[model samples]
Target: MTIISVYYTAKMTDADHKELLEARLADIRRVGDTVNLLTVIEEGFESNAVRSKNERNFSKEVNPYVRKSAVVGATGMMKVTVASLKMFSKREIQEFDNETSATAWLRDELEVKA
Candidate 1:
């Protein structure tokens, strides 16, 4: 499983934000396989308390830090939050309220039935 470990913090800049996203996308490209994007976030919501963010919005408000994933073309994450959901197509959208639910759903949905 392609697993990505991440921690969501409100402290970040647009450049740093873009850089991280690009890096993650590059990593995904390197794998070219279905992997789990495991993220250990703030357990709350993406706050807009970071500097140079509000005065200069990053084109979106996905908790600048967490938003990095979406910017990296991770549609799976893009459709996670209410604001970012519009960044993707609804063809095969899957959302789970919690990690446990998501894990089971992935196993059931992505894995073929015998």
Candidate 2:
């Protein structure tokens, strides 16, 4: 499994966010198939219409490479965003309060699937 942190993208401009998304997509593709532990743990990580559209597209693009997925630091309204992503991607993305719990869950899930 790989842990990809995109929390730094919190509060970024739309253009910057799109650029980072492209970079992250490249990284994910390089890593190939695995359980992806995505950390979106940042206070200002809110999404707008444009960001939401980018994210939906991202979810689809990464769907083939991501064997399983989990996220941490999705508090308040971010939970809604994650839920929306989950539905759009048709991927069961489990949420955790912190990185430790999320990583552990991903590990356990991988073992079960194995």
TM-score of each: 0.42, 0.78
Highest-scoring model, lDDT:
2
Off by over 4 Å in 1: 1-7, 34-91, 109-114
lDDT of prediction 1: 0.39
Give the per-residue lDDT of model 1 (tens digit) for 1-114. Answer: 445433444465555555665566556556665544443333332434352243123223222222122112222223344234335422122443455544544444443222
Count of clashing pairs, candidate 2 = 0
CA lDDT of every candidate: 0.39, 0.71
- True-vs-predicted CA distance for residue 85, candidate 1, Å: 4.0
lDDT by residue (6-96, candidate 2, tens digit) is 6545668889878888888898888876546465567667777897788778777887777657777777666787777767775568776
In model 2, what is the error at residue 89, expressed in angstroms? 3.1
Please give the clash total of every predicted structure, in order.
Answer: 0, 0
Off by over 4 Å in 2: 88-90, 109-114
Leading candidate by TM-score: 2
